[model samples]
Target chain A: MIFPPDSLEAIIFNALSETVESMVFEEVVINQFVANKWPQVENSAWWACIELFPPPISGEVIIVVPDALMNRFTEATLGMGDEPPLAEENADALGELLNTLCGRLLAMRVGPTHTFRMGLPKIGRGDTMTQEGNNHKLVDCLVEDDHIYLVVPNQFWDFNAD
Target chain B: MLKILIADDSKTARMIIQRCLEMVGVANCEYVHASDGIEALTIMRAGGVDLLITDLNMPNLDGKGLLLAVKSSPKLTNTPVIVISSLVNQALEIELNSLGVNSIINKPVSPVKLLECMESIMEKGFIS
Candidate 1:
């Protein structure tokens, strides 16, 4: 990883903040009270993941959002009035959000000149758990009162690891 | 009225892009949607599309492939393309420009940005 742990964390936070604010017109703040590790599986309703490939670095970015927050995101993205968005609609919204967030995070970390490729976002509902290891990093955030988690696992920083 | 074709895998993204295009004062236009580049190409082949807006990453053919297909074809070569994506950098921008992309708009797109890009393309006579 080109950035130190703290720097990477800050980058993740900034990317998440900008993505959410721009896409959904909502504010995201770091949830200091929550631990950086993955939260309880039941609390999360949607999990979206995208793989990043940029030369010597590679990893997957996962975004976890609870049911209420997902509803808010879907409604905002689709501009729904009364009827709830379909399951596929929610999945698409989450995937697009993850795609944008991962792209922004990579651009910020890798600079403007370096090119990077990202896989299409894959989204799923129900319980999902993060891989267990010190090789990964997690950032907990809040959109209003709901919690969201951003996880980068495996080779997220393998190049600089001691 | 101009006919615009939007190609993106996500329905949500297509809706948002259409909303932004409307907000950017592209009101008197007919909109067509495609789930990927191949579909967009099919629609273009049918004729009468004034512009093409596409997302970079998609299944069964991407924006780059779509751009190449359109620019290479004699019938579709004149149609303008605008790429909206999150995976943009200087290198990619140069590549897209070389491939005849009229404009590139970053994701989390807004009406102001869309309008600015459209105005620039309009000045170039890509759109009237």
Candidate 2:
């Protein structure tokens, strides 16, 4: 996966734009992102990631963002009111938002000639860890200041406790 | 024959873009697909991609990184890119355009409007 980065950014940025329109309507920016993860790496609190798979046989696109940003995202996504259910409600909304983003990405990529099904959304705890594998490409991005991490792989890896 | 590559994580988006480009009457045109920014780059690297359309937020490389990477490449020097999105940041948009994006298509896109956009940039041979 050592291709130029623009095309990949277009995929994520375009998907992020479309996903928000169909789902929540929160216009966002595709902020700059990097690959390494700390020490000799570059992971941060805003990191988010996802994996894509079969029929499509691709991988997922994972994304991460700060908690405060996630909170705002939940409010924007659910369109909740004064009675919004607090942190619990935000969690549910976050999962749904990511799910919608993934589903939209696959359908767009495969075109009318193919269809891909997405599994239920799993929200990673800020500290989730990822393993390396082939047939997979990782995408990291930011939306309106929220850090987003993603992956498109042929199979599902072990789920961390996030 | 102008070659166009559309990279997005959304299926609906791809359709909308395809329909829009058709409406613009871009004849003898080619449309390529990439699920994420990373794949988009891969497709472009293979050649014949004259215009690159992408979103800002995506898995793997995301939009900004993608834009930077593409512009940074010597091979893609002549290729033009269009940034279309709904991400809630204006500064990012300004930055992208300033960095040399040919145009910016704000979100909530439709077949009709997209077509109109294409028409704005239509050249002589795109239509019969």
Candidate 3:
């Protein structure tokens, strides 16, 4: 249940990269993991969350991405060209992406022996963002020239009350 | 034409699975859509559904729940189900198999893999 920040960040990066490539057909590059010093963490970022299961080891994954990248992501997933973005569609795409990413990460971590049932993904505006707790681990990366941050809470804890 | 029902909360995932079915030369099939397992069960109860392709995670009634329902139904127990999900586990696989699931497909499901699974299932006398 104790995942070092650096190790969790690396896992998130790999999961993000694989999920984007397979789901949206986009080759994402991880620029670097910006630890605790992400200035662009706000910027009206779109956020998606997928909650994990199985007690003490349970935690949730939160993905934060910029608006422009989300537009491109939605377009790529639906095989569309540049156009006015549909907010709802982009949000749905992000939710599905995180679902796949979290599943892949858990499958890798648990090695297929244990089952992790992830809850449905939730998406909303960036203002919902809160300060990370002691168990929160985060990493900032660049994909398609846009910055995205991914966070996982300690022990799959639900810090936000819905 | 075969009547296949595909259930997934994500429209994109359902679309991808349908596209794969066509790519595998299941080109002459009729597709029914549902967003959750409850809807899928309702559709199946209406009868004439040749196959079921579903996702494990959904808002109302998940894939496992749907499988349990289908297996317990005397009229629908013979219908083939191919589960396509992002989640995978050895224990879950065994449970699904015991529930009479024809095949298990992982998400980001490829046309080739789906084609192989469908062909194998069809060979077992499920398809006409």
Top of the candidates by TM-score? 1
| CA lDDT scores, all candidates in order | 0.83, 0.59, 0.78
lDDT of 2 by residue, A1-162 (tens): 233443545655676777666555566664444443321123323333444546544455565556666666666554456664465555555554565567555544454445344444455454464555454444555556555555555332222112
In terms of lDDT, the best-performing candidate is: 1
Model 3, CA-based lDDT: 0.78
Error of 3 at B17 (Å): 1.4
lDDT of 3 by residue, A1-162 (tens): 223654654555566677888777777666554434423456567888888877324766788888888888888777676685688888888888888888777765555556668899988877775545556656656676776777766553332212
**For residue B36, what is the lDDT in candidate 2?**
81
Better TM-score candidate (1, 3): 1
Write candidate 1's Cα lDDT for A48-144 as tens digits: 8887875736877888888778988999888899988888889999999998888787777776677788899988866654445455666677787
lDDT (10s digit) by residue, model 1, range B11-41 = 8889999999898789899999999999999
TM-score of chain B, candidate 1? 0.97
Docking class of 3: medium
Point to the candidate with the largest DockQ: 1
TM-score of chain A of 1: 0.83
Q: Which parts of model 3 are misplaced by more than 4 Å?
A: A1-11, A34-40, A81-85, A130-132, A154-162
In model 1, the runs with Cα more than 4 Å from the true position are A1-6, A32-36, A54-56, A128-134, A154-162
Q: Compared with the true structure, what per-residue lDDT tens digits does model 3 show for residues B1-128?
A: 79999999988788778988887789898999999999999999999999999899998799889999999999999998999988976767887788899999877677887998898888999886
lDDT winner, 1 or 2: 1
